[model samples]
Target: MSTTTYPRRHLGQGDLAVSAIGLGCMGMSDFYGAAEDERSLAVLNHALDIGINFFDTADMYGVGSNERLLAPVLKARRDEVVIATKFGNVRAEDGTFVRVDGRPEYVRSACDASLLRLGLDHVDLYYQHRVDRTVPIEETVGAMAELVKAGKVRYLGLSEASPATIRRAAAVHPIAALQTEYSLWTRDVEAEILPTCRELGIGLVPYSPLGRGFLAGAMRSADVLDANDWRRQNPRFQGDNMVRNLALADAVKALATQHGATPAQLALAWLLNRGPDIVPIPGTRQIARLDENAAAATLGLDAAVLQQLDQLLAEHPVAGDRYPAAGMAMVNG
Candidate 1:
């Protein structure tokens, strides 16, 4: 168990209570760039010490290397964390995303493969990483439900799933959480997706709650990112869009300065204030950044501050799409 004290929240009505801020482990192994395993391990340990028990990873990340990376930590502290891994986003051997697979056999095989990689018997929360439009949600979730019955998975979830798909999945099984990209810059969820989750008693897990580090008020240009850094390919981080988006980041920085909090902290605190059902999984490979993000749980935003942020975002709308054209097609399925 974590020694440090922190506020905990449940995912939906399930008994899986995790720290309000979960560590998204995708960057430790893939996407962002090259990272040392030793550094990643240290960061993971520090997260546990700081009372962050929820760790998120996907099987396709690093082409299964991400789950493998967490194996050692899970082996040592199996009972101390609420580990969540996702599937459905298939990848080829060359780390190229092949397609989204939600077939019944693929679901079973994927869970088994993830367990084999993690060297674990069961997963606490298993999510369909991306909804497979090729397959019916009922058949996909039914296969996930079978995993629950077999004691292979404790809770089921869906990532980037539409509200209609969410309803369909919940009818098949008790969906614990819905992981989606939500942050200060990406308020698309607020209008419909968020309300739908709340109505159905499914907790909201906001991925990229810091807007892929844009809301952190650091990256002034896409030129700053490493050559292989995936953010470079992101529309929001390119050309004129980046210029316009920085203005929003500047506004966030101004408000954060007034509140005496880092922009990342203020951004996260804003999401936390949205409701108790929200748990933002912000990814970081550095322990310092991890500590900075974890402190957001304690950063309180008054009604006036919240109102200011609301108006600020409303006035300075984000510039570009959250993802590229192909990536955008996968979400809200």
Candidate 2:
């Protein structure tokens, strides 16, 4: 396991705090493949054992199974970790996703459902998983603000929201963080979103920070993925794109050999050097992978190394868009 230790960072620009590196729970339940309940639980417990004080989840993950999965441990040590979960993605009765719902009623109902499944009175951090264009951001954030008022949630956050949308949401209430897909290959945020968050004193919680395992070199071939694995749908993992991305991974692997760190560890450590305001949530169900990701906190990244990374990224820009066109349309971008 990771023996490296670093000072913990503030959760946002507020009193809440967590380890510089946090655990992202999505892979344990959904994206990677079929959810292995036992293995996922073991990883969660292991995170606590290793001082990963930040744990993230969402209501829509596993259609509630993720929260149910975390319920027992959360109840036992609620005060020890910072729990972050999200809502807004709505699913129908038959498991068909209907649409994003930031409506006041849905917000309240979602919170109640998450609370019940988690067996908790409050969520330390609550986020709108996606910005619902049909609903005004002010209206949606107003509802989230109510949860904080009711003591059902302590902090508010927005995910995949555009710069304008983030500002609109903040106008209604102070949003503690903006959760979005950000990594070396996917840098749309560097243009405007990051600047806006900094101006508002909002932390940027980057999900899929290792480019959804693409940069980690853990996945070099598409044949290894499930037929329905989410990565299969990602453009970077498809036919020609996959071939080109593998070339990039090869270069990263070479660097890893020179640096004496795994590609996964190097990718994560590069993210650590991005900025203190940015917290990456790299998810995995294996304790070994978790330890490597967490140990990124201590990996060194001097000017020359960062320049080399920038050059590599520029030379082999990822071929396709990060998400499928359908999901891409939903991002407030």
Candidate 3:
């Protein structure tokens, strides 16, 4: 029971309208650190209670455990939630990274496996987690189109794809959304990828809209992260990079204070103001943090504040690459 209601935005020109802010469910199962199933289940229900219906997950998250985690919730709230999950990024049983697989056969099998794990007949939106460089975009999207024909997926999306690849894929089928890492700190998509998406009538779904919690003004030091947390290995969260980024986070905090909002709210508000077609899914395992983030949907920012944030980030540009070399190679393919 939420006193504040959230507005829905259509992902592209399609009839698929979801909450303005989505919940990214990756960290709850893996990547961040250890998490309790009971706690994660509570957060999922709480999200729906607070008017959040867009749930983003992927087959690779927790090496499939993440999809299993959502099965019970999806079963109970089948009609209320618009579940979006991804495929293409393959992983081994021990959680070792294999390779990006966009082969037609793999695409079909992956969708079946994800549906089985999710306990759902069809997913609202399905994405190719990463572009498989070895395979042509046409071949990969062709298989995805088949899924849509069979009612396995309502809409199709592409993540971390290059502008050219996006064009090629959209030519084959209408791309409902483009999920990329976008935030005040990560604006690489703005240069070309975003324009390409807009040109083709595809909405933008920004994952890690809070810079993977960096822009939240938390994590004063890299040491604060657990030993097994994946952020520890991220280039931006290590050594001198972490020190420099903390200053940027503090600046965001000060601006948020001036606007009577939390740093996470300010960050998400900024993205919400970016456009009506852009929806950002910020991940959190804590109910309090989820509420704090969902509130950003109602936190409005005027032109002056938006310009000020733009200037602050411009003056103090973020340090370090977004990912390590191996991981970086997979994006923008």
Instruction: List the candidates' TM-scores in order.
Output: 0.99, 0.96, 0.98
Q: What would the C-alpha RMSD of candidate 1 be, to one decimal place?
A: 0.8
What lDDT score goes with residue 104 in model 3? 98
Clashes of 2: 0
User: How many angstroms is residue 225 displaced in model 1 relative to the true structure, after the best TM-score fit?
Assistant: 1.0
lDDT at 249 for candidate 1? 97
**Colliding residue pairs in candidate 3:** none
Please give, for residues 230-321, the per-residue lDDT of candidate 2 as tens digits.
88888899999998988888788778778888888788788778788878888888889888888888889788888988888888888898
Question: lDDT by residue for model 3 over 1-333, one digit each (tens)?
Answer: 344477889997789999999999999999898999999999999999988999999999999999999999999988889999999989999999999999999999999999999999999999999999999999999999999999999999999999999999999999999999999899999899999998999999999999999999977887888899989999999888988888889999999999999999999999989899999999998999999999999998999999999989987799999989999999999
Better of 1 and 2 by TM-score: 1
Off by over 4 Å in 2: 1-6
Relative to the true structure, candidate 2 has a C-alpha RMSD (angstroms) of 1.9
Worst window of 10 by summed lDDT in candidate 2: 1-10
* lDDT at position 113, candidate 2: 96
Worst lDDT run of 10 residues, candidate 1, spans 1-10
